[model samples]
Structures are given as structure tokens and as C-alpha cells.
Target: MDKQRENLTAADKKSEEIIEDKRAVQIADPSKNSVAGKDTELAASQVGYQDLFDNMPNGCVYYKVLLDEAEDPVDLVYIKVNSAYGRNIGRSLSELIGKRVTAVFQELTGEGFPCMETYLNVALLGEPVNFTQYFDQQDKWYSISAYSPQPGYVVEISEDITEQTKAEGERRERERQVALIERVASLGALAAGVAHEINQPLQALKIMADSMIYWYDKGKETSVEKVIESCRKISVQAGYITSIVEWMQDSVNKAWSDAPEEVDVKKMIQRVLILVQERLRAHGIQLRENSCDNSLMVWGDSRRLEEIVIIILVNAIDSFVCVDQGAREIRITTSCVEERAVIEISNNGPAIPDDIIGKIFEPFFSSSKSGTKLGMGLAIVKSVVNAHNGTIQVFSSNQQVTFRIEFPQYRQSV
Candidate 1:
């Protein structure tokens, strides 16, 4: 028994010596030790990364790109996916892992697999891509970010943005409603001017018809030339009345459109002047217009551009209510400078208060004491101008208030 115990002790000592020699070699050979340490660290890092990826709030997917004969990436093979990814896509790990992307998104074949080109570029070219996509099958919107993890491999992260998209759409709809209401209110304020405009042509038609009937009833011989002249005059007045009514109807009923066209600034100003001229004359406000003889063109909706002029003109007309009628003057000028179309509308009515000028374009901000105005006209004007990539500024000094608007000059593409 003593001999066996000695042998056992010798064996144990031999093993201990062997272990110590290996430790000494590792310490002496720093490179070997470093390599071994790096391997351990790499393994630990991979495990940690896997844990983080699986636990990320956003969905994450890993794919291995499959190439064709031309070395062009043709399809992606699902290698790994986090729980969040499966949840977001409404699929199980069993359904995705070890499966081709085409098999999983067979329904999207009609659309050529959404972002297939984008994904392949990321995997093969190492170019990262970020984009938003709407998944019809899932009825959701997602913001996806994809980048190459290594050659021929990509990792994608996705965040659901359906609610955000819906909210933005709803907000735009609400703005459109508010803008429509403001336009109707503006037309209401111009009702008197519009009535006067229609009445003048109507009164002419009545006078011409009355003369013709009087000639016929008095037993006076009516010459063919006189009858033709009266008919021509009546036709002109009727056409004029039709044009005014048509313009008003279009203004009230036109829907907002995104398509833009080249708008002649001079013609637009003339049309708006026709609508407001009677109002200006009724208020004894003198109008001075200095427009370029050459056509000044801008790229935007004609109706919205017309609205901008009308809003400014109406504000100018209202400004005269507190001033003596004889001193009221409004000036409008259009010019082109530095590849920009510039419009300046100035009024000599009481200058906008220094404190209120800055806030005039803000929605629902009014300086009027009547409490009947919602003050959305200038706000809508600013919004429309910005939508057209234009700038508007106000200057008030020396008993004058001027609104200067600038838009990029329309240039025909070559």
C-alpha cells in the first residue's frame, strides 16, 4: 500500500511539473499567449454581440448573399434573425432561418422583392443603405438600415414607423382643411367687391336691353345696324359677367394640387387686380403697378400665387379703414434679379406695429381689434410661398409697410 501511494504521489508531481512548464513557455512566448488570449476574447465578444443583437429593440437580420455565374448577387440566404425580427415580420424562426429570402417573401416577387438591389449592393459593395418601406402584407411601414457585416454578408436593422407615417398624413389633412377655411373666409371678405364687379357688367347689359326694347315699343323704326350694335354690346357684357363668375367659382372650388407649372407673374397680377380693383376704388385707394414688360415667370401653382397677391392686397385695403381715404396708396412691383423673381407690395396706410410685424405670418395671430378675423391669411401665404421654395419678408419704416417676396426664377430644363 505504501509503494502504491508513492507511485501515485510521483504521478501527481509529474503532472504538476508538466503544467508549470507549459505556463512558463506561455509566459516566455508572448506571441503564443497573446494569440490564445485573443481567441478567448473573440469568443466572448461574439457571445456578447449575439446577446445584444437578440435583445435589441429594433428588429435585426443577418443574411449571406448568393451569387450567380456573373458574380452578381442574385438572392440572399437567411443565416440568423433576432426574436424582434421574427416578431416584426410576423414569422417564426423556423420559417426564416435556413430559408432563402425569395421563399419567405414569395408574394413580393411581383415587386421584385422590395429593396433587393439595395440589399445586394450593401452585401457585395459594402455600401450601407437606409430607407423607408411600406409592407402591404403586414400593413405597416418600416425604416430599415442595412450594412455589410463582412464580404458577401449583410445585417439589417428595422424600426416600425407605421404610426408615425399615419400621424404625418393626418397632420397634412388637417392643414389642408384649415387652409380651405381661410380661403373661404377671404372670399367672404371680398364679397362686396365681387358683387360690385358683377353688377357693373350687369348694369350695362340692362341699359343696352332697355334701349333696344324702348326703340321697339315706341314704334320707332330700328335699323339692322343699330340692332346688331346693341346685340354686340350685350354679348360683350354677358361674356364679361361669365368670366368674373367663372373665376370666383374656380377660386372657391379648386382642389390643392402638387403639380406645378410655369406661371406668368404679370398675368397673375392682372387677374388678381381685376378682382380687387373695385374694392380699391370704392375705398379711394390709388393703385400703382410697375411690372416688367417682359414676362416674369415662376414655377408654382397659379391659384396659390394669386392667393398670395390677393391676401396682401386685401390687407392693404383694410389698413386704409383707419386712415384718411385721400392719402391711401398701394404700390406693387415685379422684377427679376440674380436668377430670382421678386415682388414687392407696399402700402402707405398705418405701418404694421414694430412688435406685431414679426408675428404676422404666424397662424391665428391677429392685430385686428374687431375679433372677427382668424388671421390665417398671411400664415397660409407664408406656407404656400415656402412650399414653392420662396422667401417672404416684411419691412415697416417711414410710414410704409412693404412685403417683399422672392422665388427662384423658372428656368426651362435643357
Candidate 2:
């Protein structure tokens, strides 16, 4: 019921991908196909249309509406379904197509009743709904969406979000419980200095509050001045809380957000190097860029984008294996083509195996045999990049590995 829970409840959920699919649908009028040299007969064939919808890679559903005695939208019947939909829920089209909405969905929920209420509202209103709700009994994250194209029936689609959700949850939990503890311990080491600095502000606020209370108690018909002073004291306290929360949120989302923002492309490359300055110094890696042009601007979160560069560069530094390997160098270059910024970062390291390039983006995949390879760093980077509407590729040959990332400058975010 709190704000964050409410946010999760109202999130894009499974519909984010569904919405993207909707955008990809190029529905054309069957009537115009003949003149356009299109398959007019194929266009008019409802069976073919239904078959195509059913055969789609993703689960698809089509529901029919049936009204009640009161002329209100009351029932739902699945008029069409794809094989994926049936397989996901372990139900045949015949079993689900004619069932009442409440009857079929009522028992599948974890919280039982609350989820049912959410469904009923969507069914009655004839609107599409999306949320990251869980079916407690199923114990998995689902990107779920319910749509009612007509007055009385609802169509629903669900996608498993477990892997991505679990990764994010684990990352967040570690930051909250583990990383914060480390940060707090570090703060504790500076506790005396922090306390002494904080006490000054606390004392100032308290003195103002006390003076305001005295004035308000005295014979002032309307204590506007005192009220303002008290409000100012409250602001000071709220400021402290805001600072802590902002610091935490910046550390969290700046490093990783489900969605990435398009950045000024020319600036972002330089910015990435700035982020890895300490690492470059520590590893003795000489970094160079081919072009320092001012024209390109790519799309994506600079923070997460920079993380990818840092991870790859760190691996490049590690590839030296010995400090005596003459000079460790990483070269980065970028070009813009058809408004897409193509960034290439390459290192002169041992060649990556031909088989390994395909699996690098897979979660928990690593080339390193050491215990230190958590295996998810690159996976997170790829996920973050993908969510930004970009693509990443790797090419490896003798003594070199190249990561080529293409970022399109969306005039308006899609």
C-alpha cells in the first residue's frame, strides 16, 4: 500500500514488451490489398489471420464479450489463443476459451482475493491493464497484461520475468543490506567528524524552533512569523532525509535502471574515460580514442554505458597476465551511420575463443576460471544496454577482442 509497492503494482510489467509488439504490428486494410498488389484472398481469410496469430512466437489471446441481463459487461470467453499461451499455462484452447473470467482466474492468484478484484475491475472497464504482480503460488515474476477490446471479454498475456527480476532484486538487496553497511562503517570511521559537523545544523534548527514556540505562545493575534520559522525547521529536517535518500537512489539507478536514457554521444565517450580514471591509473592501461569529433550523440544511460566500457577495459588490463607485457593499451573509436552511433572498443589481449563470443552475454557466463569471476557483470551491462533500445556485438581475432555497440539517436524516445 506504500508508494514503492504501489509503483510496482502500477509498473509496465509484461506490457512493456507487449506494447513494443503492438508497435511492430503492421495491420493493413484487407480491402486495399488487391490494388496494392497484395494477397487480397489471403488478407480476407480469417482462418489464415487466426492461424498466423496463433503461430506467433509470443503467447497471444483473443477474447469475446458476452453481456449480462443488466446489459453490463459481465463475462469473458477466449475466442482465440496461440500454442505458446496454452503451453505456458498448461491449458488447452478448448478448456480456457469458453470459461467465465472469474471462474478460471479466481483460483490462480497467490493473495487469492486482492488479485481477483484487480482482474474484475479491468474486465468491467474494457481497458488494457499492466502490472508486475506475482501469482504467489507460482512464485515467479511475470510481466502481465490484460486487455478488453470489446465490452464484455478480457484477453490476458503473461511473460516470465523471473531471471531479470531476480537479478535486479539480488543486486538491490546486496546494495541495501551489504553495500550500505560498508558505507555506514566507513561513515562510522568518520563518525566524530560527521557528528561534529551535523551538531551545528541541529543546534541551529533547535534554536529557531524554540524561538518560534516562544513567540507563538506570546500575545500575537496571528503568529505568521513563528509559523514560518517552524516550517523552516521542518524543511531542515526533511532536507537531511532527502539528502540520504537521493544519495542512495543516485548510487542505485545511476548505476542501473531498467530503462536507459539517450545521452549526448560525443560527450558520453569522454565521460566514460573520466569514470575509469582511477582504474586506468591502477592498471597502467593507456587508453586512446581515434576521433574526438563533436558531431555524434548516441542514446543510452551514460552511467550504465560507462559500466560496459569499464568492465571490458578491466578485462583487457587483466589479459596482460603479467605487468611485464611491454605496454597495455586500449583503443576506442566511434562513427555515425544513418544516425546510429557505432562505438568500437578493442584491446590487444589474448584472442577470445570463437565459441566464447556467443556466450559472453549469457548470465553467469565467464572466461575466467578464478573464483573472483562473479560472471554477471557483463550480463548486467548487456541487459542495461538492450533496455536502452541498442545492440552490442563482439568480434575477436588473433590477439584482439572488439566490442562494437550501436546506439541509435531516437528523435523521440520510443
Candidate 3:
């Protein structure tokens, strides 16, 4: 009798708990509530969500990811959005809440919205994604984070990054200005050296002309061979002057305008070699070429590409001057790696110490001679590479410093 009473007591308690659970479910269900109760609960839930949506500092949006027959997200319908979101997109909640994303912004589909595509993927796949978007139409930038709470819904948190982008652009412009100033300063320093270089050939020409005139005036039979040799000397010297002037002009003009096209990589390197060859020879530095392929090509501004090669070569040339008396040599090699064009320019000068190697590409960082302190060459090289969607790196070992640059391969259109 005592055991039966204990079992009965337990059964009664379990039944009462089940009844309480049902009542709780009923209270949560609006359909099970009285009309007034249903309205009150629904209003409370909406107020809670509204308070959360309005309190965020950044723009907040909830979208229903619309799907086609194939179950791919075809478009997005704005379900709920805060005031900040509406203000960001130049629309009000009343105007956008029921509208489709594609209907409002056609450019999104025409060009593409990689960021939005990722957001829809997150909603469909139940993952989270973060990306930056540049809206060309509104000239705004946004840092967005998106995640899905349900199968067909996405919540996006966005912050306007237009100011940040503007600041970055301003910084780049300032760097460009600094680079220009440094380039001008380098030209100023080289002016005397270049004049001296030109003077040597000029003096030689004067001597040759004087000798020819003197021989003719003395009634000496000037052989045709001698006259032809003097003429050839004059032509060579004149050609040298023309080449120097052309190189200088091209270097300056390329900085102002950059138009990209398919460029022959090997041919462009040879052009830079022509410009710097005399300087290298004057310094007793020997140049060795290896692994070069004539057919290698890249899509870029040829003149700008030449500038990149020139900067690296000139830097190597400068290093040779500062090194202790030894065999000065520069090795230029090129190869294709994973469909990317790779060029390695290495010099057996002094090794750049490990501590400063990383900073070599930083703006205004130079290890060059005193009074030539504008260290913007490598900085400019890096900027140009980044603009071209390429990469550059430096390595130093055993008194050898090398700069390795890689560029995307260009394929010709059929």
C-alpha cells in the first residue's frame, strides 16, 4: 500500500507539469490567445525587435532571400531596415521595405555586386560573410557583415567606409606627390653627371672635326676611309645624345598618363638595359642575363613598366658604387612561374641588413648616399605593382641583394 501511494504521487506531479507546459506554449502562440492578448504579445515582440534594430550605430537591414525554381537566390526583398540603412541608401523604409533589390539598383546586376553575392550565399548556406562594397552609383563605400538566422533570411550590418576610402586616396596622392618631388630631386642631382657624360663625346667630336679640317687645310690628301670614319664618329655621338633625351622624356611623360596594353616583357627589359647600360659599364659592373624568354608578355603600360625596371636597376647600380672594391656584377633573370611572369634583378653589392630589409619599400626610407635622401623609388615601384595587381619582394644573402617582381601573364585575343 505504501509503494502504490508513492507511484500515484509521482504520476500526479508529472501530469501537472505537462499541463503547465501546454499553458506556456499557448501563451506563446498568438493563435491560441484571446484577440486582445494576441495583439499585445505581437506588439511587444515587434517593439523588442524595433528597439534592437534602431539602437545599432551602423546601418542594419533584414532581407528575405528570394529563390527561383532552381533554389538559387535570384533577388532580395527588404523585410526590415532601420533608419540608418534607409539614409545610407537614399531611401525610406516605406519606399524600400517591399521592393526588390534588383528593381531598385539595376547596376548591381549589370556590373556585379560580389559583396551581395556573398551575402546571399551566406543566407542560403547558413554561414557568415564579411566584405567591403563600393557602390559606384552613390559613390559610397561600405564595410558589411552578413549572416543568416533562418533558411531564407539574411541580416546585414553595414558601416559607411566612404571616408576611410577617401582618406586612403588622399594618402596615396600625397605619396605620389612625394615621389614626384624625389624624382625631380634625383634628376637635379644627375644633371651635372649627365652633362659631364655628354661633354666627353662632345669633346671627342670637336677633336675629330679639328683633325679633319686641319688635314684638308694643310693640302694633305684626306683618304676616303678617314673621312668616313670621322663621319661615323659624329653619327654615333649624335645618336647617343638622342637616346638620352628620349629616355628622359619618356620617363617623365609616363608618370602623368598610364595606358595599359599587351607589352613584350623581354623587349621592355632590353629597352631599360639600353638606358642604363652605359652607366653600369662606367662603374665597372658586369651584367649577366639568364632565364630570359623572348615571348613572355604582360598587360601593362609599357613606359610605366620600363620605369619599374629602371628603378630596380638604378638602385642596384647605386649599391655597387658604395660597396668595397670587388667584382661588381648584376644578374638579371626572368622566368614564368604558375602563368605569372617573374623577373629577378640581383646585385653582388653590399647586403641589405636583415633589420632594414622589410622597410626598404616604405616611403622615404633610403639606404642611398647622403644628400640623395628621397627614398621614394622603391615605394613608387611597390605602388605601381599594386596598381597592376602584381607583387614585389626583396631578399638578401651572402652580400647579394635581389628584388623579385611578378606580374600576371597576358593572353592575346584571338
1-414 in candidate 3: lDDT tens per residue?
Answer: 999999999999999999998888877885766876878989999999789788777999889988899987888888988989888877878988988877766633365444667777888789898888888877889998899998899999999999999999999889778656655644543444455456656777899999988988999998899899999999998787778778777667765654578888888888878766667766788899986544789998786677778778877777776665359999999999988999999999888888889898888898755855567777878877876789999999977888999999888879
Q: Candidate 1, which segments miss by more than 4 Å at Cα?
A: 1-20, 65-75, 106-128, 147-154, 220-230, 256-264, 277-286, 292-300, 314-329, 336-341, 347-401, 406-414
Please give, for residues 162-191, the per-residue lDDT of candidate 1 as tens digits: 999999999998977876666676566456
Query: Candidate 2's residue-wise lDDT over 159-178, tens digit each?
Result: 77878999998988875564
Q: In terms of TM-score, how similar is model 3 to the real structure?
A: 0.53
Q: In terms of lDDT, which candidate is stronger, 1 or 3?
A: 1
> Model 3 scores what on Cα lDDT?
0.80
- Residue pairs with clashing backbones, model 1: none
How big is the RMSD of model 1?
Answer: 4.6
Please give the ranking of all candidate structures by lDDT, highest first, separated by commas. Answer: 1, 3, 2
Better of 1 and 3 by TM-score: 1
The TM-scores, one per candidate, come to 0.76, 0.40, 0.53
Highest TM-score: give the candidate number: 1
